[model samples]
Target: MAFTPPKETYTGKVYTLEIGVPPDTVRFGGENVLPLHGFEGIVPSRPVIAYEIQDIPPDDWPDTVKKPFKDVSDDPVSWAKFCRDALKARAIALRLIGTHPDRENRSPEDAAKTVRDILSAIDVPLIILGSNHTEKDASVLIAAAEAAKDKNCIIGKAQEANYKTVAAAAMANNHKLIAMSELDINLSKQLNILITQMGFDKERIITDPMCSALGYGIEYTYSVMERIRLAALLQNDATMQQPMLGDIGMYVWKAKETQARPEDVPPWGSLEERGIAWEAVTAIALIIAGAELLVMRHPKAIEAVEKVVDELI
Candidate 1:
């Protein structure tokens, strides 16, 4: 007799989310098994990775990551097109970092204009992100949501402080919302409940339990994400069934491993290879932890993660 592998099944499935308009949309989640555990149950879609761009130049990004977009980074539209056409990016995430009060202090109107311009320039799905300033994001995301109305973009990052207003904006404009919380499973579920309480359909929301780099508390982040996935599947918790987001680039690029110069940290190897590998490893870890959508920088890093996803699925 042949030996057989034991398999486990689940009672719940993640909500499948579609972003962008028809003919160009991208979908993820809707899996009844844990990540890459398709042998046990249905796993309908592969993870989606979106290249991260900013409305303003990435002046603060370390040289290693910034070198790729040097020529087109000066303008958001040009930068977005480069990602789509040159890098073959399936989706794009535009962070309005310049709109932050501490940065260029660009107004909601300016952010809206940037959204319109980028939308016109690329056909791929766009994820509009605020600078993570809770107070300012409420206003900025509202304007950005309206600007991308009917385009079926994903507008985000409604936190506890501004979920009501931001959720309302995304609902009214017909865009998906990203509900982010600190690295706690309860907080993650609570935020999802709060957003749905406002009448925003829970299926349209993406839960971001937040993200951390490889050496910087990543184990904690992974545990929180894995527990969330288990609740969604094993416990059949509706509130925890939404797909997860790993905002990889922003967190990984800032880590000391990615930014430290080889000369300064003699044992760390080449700066460029170190940064790319750091990002790829962080992204792969999060994918295995149950992230269905990712926002990443570094073309080489994205390529490496894509290869890994292919082999896993």
Candidate 2:
């Protein structure tokens, strides 16, 4: 006689992807500790909306974008305060765009002083950015890092070309870092691996999968981020798990979808309203897709995205 045993079946219901970090409580300078990874805990950092300010006047910004900031465009410290006090910004990302040799060619001292001045003015956390010029950033981030010592802020988008010095600064000063790659998983992983090799801890690192605004390869950007998240959870890839960072404002504000004129495209509605919606929609998509921290621009966009986050989490 053949004996029958219990039969087990597998269910197809989707399991949530819990990627990135281990279950150990991670502390940030001893105050707040994040529980788990992957969309964990009140965003722990409330999706920091960093009002973007360049070291010099933003000439390349779209005219419509420039008009809103026209009054505070000249002074960096005043601009920093405006974003924090008036605009109600949670944080600020000061991009030293002027430091690029090809741009105004401002020196490391200039960058350092600006960082010092802004830090003095704003009580909120700051994200000190480089000019996006690889060679210049290597120098600027170090000076800015030294200027911001003990502040415990974030310094970054440290790429493969310049991670050594930047990583050292962040490590020495006890600050967070943004690891950037050119929208490639391998590159992102490689950079993260290299940075940690220099002794920076995992929690101190944030991944910039590199965001693109709507209509301009947003799908590709989103797919890359979503895949990074999936890899972290399913495969338990540590490099992929570090809290994902999105530069929503940088991409969204520059995209045509946010810039379409009412006269040119009647269906898009008011430019300002449409731009804000575009940014919020892009940001919300990222949060749902697993973004922990965001560096955004528009006030309305931040408010809208925060509400959606409140509902989702």
Candidate 3:
């Protein structure tokens, strides 16, 4: 017999989703093999990185990461346009951080208007996110989803505390949903089951099993993602088969390695280069662990990740 390579076969396939209006859309998921294992099965699309922007000025962001958007960060619409026109971002995630009760405490109407403006400005896919205050997100995200109605956006972060409201809004607006759960396989599965139980289609869901920074429990995150993927592909667990979301920039940029100054950490080298590497490493690791979609901040980090994806695919 001719020598043959043994490849693990998978029965389950990730749900394919399209975001943004037609003529300017991106597709993700729909793979039958392990990440980057194209020889074993089909990998229809490479993972996508969506540049992350915020509804208000990102004053909280550290100076290093904040420097790139210094000119446009004051206006969300202008920041989004810069990402689309200059940075060539494939997708844009507009996080309504201003709506947080502690932050600007912007009203739902403010969130809605911001969505409308960003949608009008950018043709790439939009990922609408709330300030992540569970209670506030229930209302804020509802307004944002309705604002982007019929645009095929991904309205997120329906956690255990607020899945019903967010899921209903996404369902009502005819958009995709993101179900987030703490980093546990069982919790992830349970949340997915709960969302689908509320009459939302499971095929339209994306699983965000809460990501972590490179040093802080990233291995735990890695293992959870790996298990989720194995459950989806090997065991054919329908509840765990939705595509994964890394949300890489939020976690990666916060780590000490990314924020520490060269004067403080002489061994780490340049702060800017260190931050970029921090994000790129985390993103690549997640992809290997089965993340099909990512939301990132730094342009340099995004460029590095895209280069790696190009080489792998």
Sorted by TM-score, highest first, which candidate order results? Answer: 1, 3, 2
| Segments of candidate 2 deviating more than 4 angstroms | 1-46
Q: How many angstroms is residue 309 displaced in model 3 relative to the true structure, after the best TM-score fit?
A: 0.6
Which of the two candidates, 2 or 3, achieves a greater TM-score against the reference? 3
lDDT of 3: 0.92
Instruction: Provide the global lDDT of candidate 2 against the true structure.
Output: 0.74
Ranking by lDDT: 1, 3, 2
The top-ranked prediction according to lDDT is: 1
Model 2 reaches what TM-score against the true structure? 0.83
Top of the candidates by TM-score: 1
Per-residue lDDT over 172-248 for candidate 2, one digit per residue giving the tens place of the 0 to 100 score: 87788889998898898889899988888876788888888877777877787777766665566666677777888
For candidate 3, what is the TM-score? Answer: 0.98
lDDT of 1 by residue, 1-313 (tens): 9989898879989999999987889999999999889999988999999999999999999999899999999999999999999999889999999989999999999999999998887788999999999999999999999999999889989999999989999999999999999998998999999889889999999999999999998898899999999999999999999999999999998898998888899999999999999999999999999999999999999999999998987
TM-scores for all candidates? 0.99, 0.83, 0.98
